[model samples]
Target: MTSNFLIFDCDGVLADTERDGHLPAFNETFEHFGAPIRWSQDDYAELLRIGGGKERLASVLTPELVKEAGLPTDPRQQRDVVLSWHAYKTARYTDMVRAGRLPGRPGVARIVAEAHDAGWGLAVASTSAEESVRAVLEHVVGPELSTHFSVFAGDDVAAKKPAPDIYQLALAQLGASSTSAIVIEDSHVGLTAALAAGLVTVVTQSSYTADEDFSGAALVVSSLGDYPADPTVVLDSPHGTAIVGHVGIDDLIRVRAAALSANSTPGR
Candidate 1:
């Protein structure tokens, strides 16, 4: 018998962690570290284009910016400095999660429970630190459901999203084929990674990714939609798969099948 896997991307997908959670944590970390740097919402939105937190922080490092910010000059020292900042940011982010400052996405708990009941193999693939990822996952899905998730995050893979390395690593660790799993991602970067790895993907747009292109996704929704209060809004479905009302287990199965069909094409 074949087993199915549900791979979730933390942060935006699991919880609206970018604007509320990560952005604030990053700004606070910089303040705490005495680096006269603070990422405005606009700046951080652009920074999200970079995959990892440390990578995002490092992207602003130029000769002028480094000197202006009084950051370390030596290459090794610069790297260490970035690592330290990232460590502090992760700690701050974890604290925010524990404090329930970041709430899970609309349908996170509903879908997680549904998926769990169906015996799906669950996992979280993220560019964030492991502790942060685990904390968010536990908060979103509760302790029991979170335990069912195999988390692969933060330096676990040499490359991050849009690289396919992390997704590949998750597939390997889960001992599951790319076709047997479906990825729930919020950004084009994560979509690109999942697609490159031959996995089906359902994109739930987040604050930072609303305008980003997700041309290859099987289905795109505003949120997963827990029902009554928050309903899943279908943004795009290239395969013509119908998403009646909120997206539920049936919708996911159909989306996965559509992806499988799309991927099974000749030379594709």
Candidate 2:
């Protein structure tokens, strides 16, 4: 029998790790290296638009930032510095995870449990470091669930989100076709990546991704919901409000069905 698969993005989707994990880690790395740079929440929010950590750092190497930060003008030197920063930032982020400072987003553990019980194949596709992704998986879903997932993360593929490389790699690794799988994403970049891979996607807004556009998502929600707490989170947007219940295998199945129907329709 064929199996259904669900692909999830790390960072925002699994947890609000950007604020608690990434941003702080990056800042700490900067301070450690005496780079004279710090990313406030707003600053990091803008930097989040960039796909990669190194890319985001490289973006600030402008004349103004160079003047302000006293950075090297040589392109190769700048690249090396950015790589070093990212490496250190990754280590700091992993330390935060190891210390159990970052918690899973509401409903993440429950949803993963439900999906696993229903025999869904699980995978994570992320631009973050593989170790970071693994740490999150272990934290949110526990070691058993973590062991079950096929993780495709940073440096595993040539390109990052909004390009579909990671998602495409997940599909290939899982031996599943796009139609047989669904993706869960928080950022517009992640949603774009999943949709571009011809997979149905569901959006669960996180702290930093609440304002992102999710035009192609099968459903856009504020969260997956918490059992014994709330069963759904109503998503508010200019379009209207959408009530998304705590996501389960059924929700993913429905999303795949809708995508199949949409694909079948002409001019859709």
- Top of the candidates by TM-score: 1
- The TM-score of predicted model 2 comes to 0.91
- Residues 1-268, candidate 1, lDDT per residue (tens digit)? 4398889999899999999999999999988988778889999888888899999988877899888888889999999999998999999999999999999999989988998888888899999999999999888889888888899999998888889999999999899998789999999889999899988999999999999999899999999997778888899998889876688887888998887887778997
TM-score of each: 0.96, 0.91
Expressed as tens digits, the lDDT of each residue in 3-29 for candidate 2 is: 888788998889889988899998898
lDDT of each: 0.90, 0.83
How badly does each model clash, as a count of residue pairs?
Answer: 0, 0
CA deviation > 4 Å runs, candidate 2: 63-71, 236-245
Query: Stretches of candidate 1 above 4 Å error?
Result: 265-268
